[model samples]
Target: MSKIAFIFPGQGAQYVGMGKEIAMEHKSAQDIFEKANESLGFDIKKMCFEGPEEELVKTEYTQPAILTTSIAILSVIQQNGIEADITAGLSLGEYSALVYAGALKFEDAVKLVNKRGKYMQEAVPLGKGNMAAIIGLDRKEVDSIIKEAQDVGTVEGANYNCPGQIVISGEINAVEKACELAKEKGAKKAVLLPVSAPFHCSLLKPAGERLSEKMESLNIGSLQRKVISNVTGDYIANEKDIKDLLIKQVSKSVLWQDSIELMLDGGYDTFIEIGPGKTLTAFTKKTARKLKKKVKCYNVENTKTLNKLLTELG
Candidate 1:
């Protein structure tokens, strides 16, 4: 009676040659990549398989790249007769989860994410917004630090990654001030992240507003599987709320920890991270440990991981 969930990674997980192997080996995976290339009107396949590294890192490029690779891998997994009972993703990955749950078409999701990336990148001026990871601090401690740091600039929690790890984002001065305060208050590490913009913070509210307008022209369908929302960290109760929650998700802290807890409590014991890097896998294990729950983790970026998954699960 082990239920499984398919989770996806968000931005910052892309690397050169993410989906090359699978695309070369599996027609299903290759088709997904082809569809993405056609959908975006650019050679995303080249950027992913043989990246210049510079173009791949741009926020406008990064979001759809990761989504394309993730969906390609998901196609291969499904072709092998593997599936998940539920789905969720972190930040940008939520759109991929919606696609897996039949709430979105891949073509539409790709176009939407492309617009989303551009909007977010343009929301804040470069070098003005910043993000930092505060390790070894509890939620309340991070909250206190953020509130205290606001005197210096606007700072707020970005992602509640796990019990002892949190990411803060906002104006550069405020984020730096929060990092200094976190270290002084016994944080193990407060490291600045190399990201383009201050994502998942109040500073990006304008990006959410832009996304709302873009989504107005898009169509939403019925869900085929249960999917969780990054804004609520709970089952999306109504499809009508998807647009609103996604808009709020851009400016609010991503409730990744809560999403994992909800799945764990619902008896989802196996998690398959269907994406490039193992970021979501690590987060899931950390969250499970904090709640004294046991779970299995797997990721499929290339043929090797995919084979391992088939051997163990198939």
Candidate 2:
């Protein structure tokens, strides 16, 4: 049997009405959403289902909303008897993976992410920091470009998403300079990302430090499933290390491609992205193809995708 891995998406994947259908059709999913409202002391469902896009897009609101929706879908998946051998997620999505791995409680994860989002947003003022996706460039090339661009200001590679695709984040001028330098260096496309803050870059170290202090106060549980750390792109074995890894993840580059490669090399061939968007699924497929590995990819977001996953995975 092919081994299974459950992956979750990060910030940009969220949207209004993401979990509405699942919550309406699945009792387990609904209960998860209800629990989020109780723990959050706010109508997160309303923000997700009937969003004023502006409100929903705020980093503070977006993190919790995405985490709740992902976990809600995860509840339905668990109710169906589906399970994963290993799990991982993109930046904010890592919290969902940790919850799924039993390293943290749902309530605790939701609260932590809400605080994380707020801290990250406040780390750097808006318009002062930015991120850009450098397409059609290998890691070394992008790294070199970033190194050169650093002379202009503080910019560094943030997300090594997949083959030929990496994101850089830092000061706006530095990011723009990197994009221009990348284009001149034969990169196919260098597009500025639509994000509120320069996440996964050194600029967010202050946010990470605050998060570390908050994490030290929590009673994190032992993991039931292996979760790949974005900071290291490796299995996070020691429960004691989870807090530090999470803190470092806020500012370090997300080794998404490396994480997926590690799993695939370990003989896992199935990936199910449990979240709102197909972002992680798309990246998984691309990474697998680049690695010349045969893999199965699926995502569960709504009734349609859930039914398809059930039909196929079963």
lDDT on C-alpha atoms for all candidate structures: 0.93, 0.93
Could you tell me the lDDT of residue 198 within candidate 2? 94
| Model 1 spans with C-alpha error above 4 angstroms | none
lDDT of 1 by residue, 30-97 (tens): 89889988999998889999998999998888889999999999998998899887999999999999
- List per-candidate RMSD values in Å: 0.8, 0.8
Lowest lDDT sum, 10 consecutive residues, model 1, at: 215-224
In angstroms, how far off is 75's CA in candidate 1?
0.5
lDDT of 2 by residue, 125-216 (tens): 88999999999999999999999989989998899999999999999999999999999999999999999899999999999999988887
Clashing pairs in 2: none
Q: Please estimate how well model 1 matches the true structure, expressed as its whole-model Cα lDDT.
A: 0.93
